[model samples]
Target: MLQRGGAHHRRPRAIERLVGAAKPTASIRALNFASNEMLFLQTCDIPSDITSTEALGWIGFDNTTAAEIFERYIARPDPTINPADLLQYVYGHISRLLTSNLRNLPRVQAMRVVGLNKPIRRALLDPCYDQILWTQDLHFWVKDTLKINYATLMQLQQQLGNYIHQRRSKQKQKPASVHGMSVVPPPAAELRHWQPEHTATVNMIPEDHNLPASHVTVSASPPTIREGHLMLYKGRAATESINQDGPIADDGSISMEVLSTCPGGDFNWTSPAQYWTPEKDVAEQFRRWAEQRCPYSETWLLAIQLSPEFARGLKREELWFSRDWKEYAWYCKKTKQPLSKFNHFWNDPPAGADLMEGHICTGVTTAISRMKVEEIQDRIDEDHVLQVGENETKAKQCVFLSAGAINRLGREMRGKLHIDIYAAIQSQEFSEGLEAIALK
Candidate 1:
């Protein structure tokens, strides 16, 4: 033990405690530097200078991030980590950190969380994983199954919470917001004469509450198994098909297994073959619901729910809701797609023709749902798929929009402009609002 340097801090409690923990040993091996963080260590500017490699004692390290964090940490040569001892380091280091500030600890009984069943993978990257970690679901599962103490679980949660917040902050800092018609700016040549009609690009997506970004419905949700190209479960006759009765884009039998109606599910929410008619009882019900939720038109539902960004739009209160294909088809014309695939431009649009009437001018009608969004949240999991119903064999009649379909539409909508409700309003205030926003 060689003690060469000396330090004198006027307020030296923190530094003394950290550097002077051992009475006999001079060269310290491993030490908890939480005190130094909370109160700067007066002993030295750099804390790493106070530790010895042999004393840093190898501990088990479990990485929440798949490779970015776990691999990167382990890969680094400075802090050599042994794979066998990684998990130990994770538990010990996190536990130590949790104890730094406990002035007003909860008076509740101490409950301890033993550990996760599996190594946390894709901590921040995977939505399904994030949901489990953030919610009490995973903690309770670990507690019930492993009988981990409740107190321990709380600390674990705090640790995860702090870590997640840190990652999100870093993520937010790196990406600058993109604002314009296009989600990203076009090349320099195109920018030379950028016009309002030119799609602007925005880098940041508003935080989505209706559907969590991580809850990837496409990857996580069960696939709809199909037997043939044309779906056999064409509940409606060929004549009663969509107004266009266009060529069937897909002809395949849906896997009857995954199509189960939610238990106690209201049949009224079932998909309608055509657009809503105000005279219809269902339409009136929607009207009343809309009348209560927003100050503006309820018929907006018909307009808003058509885009691939329907989920995002809904959460942001951006799109109008549509009840049937008519309103949905009408709204798509506003989107900036070459084919207006969401509208008539697609060869197989539900409506028979292309909507020359671009985005609906403001003061247009919208629909409101009798059901609250919370109700939908209760019925569907983060994956945006309805929970497996009591009867697995029976296929669900119709969904407002299935996970697969939404993913497909979104994939199609990427880089394509749909009508922007916000811009359309400005145009509506003036005559020839449509031409003003259009590409010359």
Candidate 2:
């Protein structure tokens, strides 16, 4: 019976040798171990009663069977070995088989060896040696199967760590401010100049009480990705001047010619009669002009331009604009109340409207009127208190002018033209305006 059993095994071994020696095509060599000969093995009449498990038992190989074999091999008198040594042996063997089969190399060759000492030390010789060994085997199998190397695996690990850290850092960051506060970095590329056509209201107010008065608010809504130069203009005078010219020049200069007429000089300059009346009407007229002319222009305004020195002094310096005209108007809204009656009249008022009428008349007069009411509301909502007293005080001291022109003026005047605008404007309007203003 023993000889008969031995003879049966020899028959299978002979068949295996024949199959191994057969000249396989390139495609057949590429076939995986589970696929190439599994069907043929199944088709062969080894035994009708034998299951795959039984067959594996007969052959002394399978998932658990391989581990058992490895354990038995490790349990010799020389079994006093590091678990990683055994793991290295298994990994090396599998890697060799995979490379040899996939590459269609000679039947057998010396396998590539990978050092496990470093990894074993890194794993700290934990009690979960079996789990670690299994994991390493799986890793080696995948690397060998995919034809990758240790260096590639290490690189993948490093990339995975970086990705995880980045995600965690983003999650841990504070949320964006609800008040629309953002700390934007300075633009790195050349920015498109702000266009007047894109203008949106930040505040508005009516020409009512002289105490707190009506105010209209305007703010800039910058694009998601902004580049190039930016300008921010505070006070109605500066803003109106910017609207007339187009978006402020990158260096903050306003060209008198550009202000007088539209680009290409196609549109004739028509100073709206109602716009330049009583000084109280200035704010409303400016709003109307901005709405009519500023929208659709290709320019970008930076909050920094409005007050450069103030922006520089900020803890988180960034260019931004407000967009709360409705809120501002609501805050400024008031019911009719008794007031001291006053009377005034005008004559030959800029070639439009009766001086006694004291009302602005223009194509955009309605928009200006509504904006004036909103501006007063905004101040009332803000409690008529200075939000940034020190910054406001400093900004008042600084003058609004083209940065490039300022530099040029300084160079021409040998830095003698460093006087602030309120002082200069008080002394002489034309000289101060000429000294500071320029066109792109």
Candidate 3:
């Protein structure tokens, strides 16, 4: 984490802002619910080039100076670097870019990345790049950029959720926030000790740690500072103030009582393909949850949070030499099989796996769409995984679950499976499961 010794320092010297024209055009398609194409596709569906960092051989900036980005990003011979080591390397690389390069200063400032696997300390940091757009500004940005009036709908949904919470007794409802799960302030219950609460409350919080593990988009809501600011949230000062003369006119753009949602992290920046899994799949979880809860509601507005790390595992070798497109994980079948030439684009089975029709394709199996609930919930699936060197039974479950939701839900995910992920630190469920996440 970025060390803060004492008082806040003066804002760093202002540098020339990065022009949009200077940066390469982002190829990712914008979200459009009205368009049949947008609604039909999955959020995790990604182009190999966009998700693959190796796809960019070099970045030529608008700067007249001839220094290209990622020059030092040489391929390492060792592919077996552990997660911790890999994280450290990435951290060091980003740090070096911020300190050493002038062209990168703009992106570095906009990102406001404090440290590897750490929350951003926005309030303390100098407003060095205020002109640039940050993640939190997406609500307004989407309206202006896409020429779509989504901001109005989003605000309405927030109001609707708030109304629901207020009308329903605390005994019956969750204190819902339209913001990403992690962005909500940590409750008094979590700040103190163990206590029995509603199962919903228990299901709300992040993982066991006191700190929020999910990425949160801070909002305009006023924050109580005496509670202790961990430099996690985006203070109201940073948010774009919305001037509502009254509740916005009902455009009926979203016909149903808009039930808006937000997961954590920057899904716009990454694909959620990492969450696909054979077990505890987000698709299965959602299918079961929806089926059991509100089978009447044909449509659900789902918000899934995609971490920055989600789609970043693509290596140079994977893009060019190797065909393994799946995220490496303990339970993923692709990780267990030997690294052989398997075409992920095609339906060809990997070497050695029995080619039963719609059965085990080994490295690349799309059979997740037809996975039975028993098969997904079964603990026996965990036993089958090939544990090579590591004996650890757990890793980040949310990441795997996100990928699983997409893989299992596929095109149906956009319409049904809303994968809103928050940091374990941010999620009540991830933190204190069945605890006090629902508490106001």
Candidate 3 residue-wise lDDT, 1-440, digit = tens: 00000111221121011112222111111121112111111111111221122212111112211112222233445446632322233334434432333223443352333221111223112233221222123222212211111222223223223333433444244543322221122233231221212111111111111112121111112223222211111001100122322101122011111111122221101222222222223233333222222111112112332232323321111111111212121123322332234323112223211111111111111122224323433322322221211352221112221333333322222212122222211121222322354463
Where does candidate 1 stray beyond 4 Å? 1-288, 296-299, 302-402, 413-440
TM-score-best of 1 and 3: 3
What TM-score, computed on C-alpha atoms, does each candidate reach?
0.15, 0.14, 0.19
Global local distance difference test of model 3 = 0.22
Instruction: Write model 1 residue lDDT over 92-162, tens digit each, in one string.
Output: 33342134132123211111122221222122123323222221122222222211122212222222233
Candidate 1 CA-lDDT value: 0.23
Candidate 3's TM-score: 0.19
Task: List the global CA lDDT of all models.
Answer: 0.23, 0.23, 0.22
Considering lDDT, which of the candidate structures 2 and 3 is the better prediction for this target?
Answer: 2
Local distance difference test, candidate 2: 0.23
Q: Write candidate 2's Cα lDDT for 1-440 as tens digits.
A: 00000001122232233333222110011011112221111011121111222222222133464454355445545545544443244444445444434334321121222222222222323332222122122233233222212222222222223323343365454432212433221121211111111111111111100001111111112212224322322211112221122222323232223222111110111221111111212322232222222211111111221134333322221111123322221221211211211111111223211211111112111122235443543432222221222242101112212233233322322111110001111113332343376431
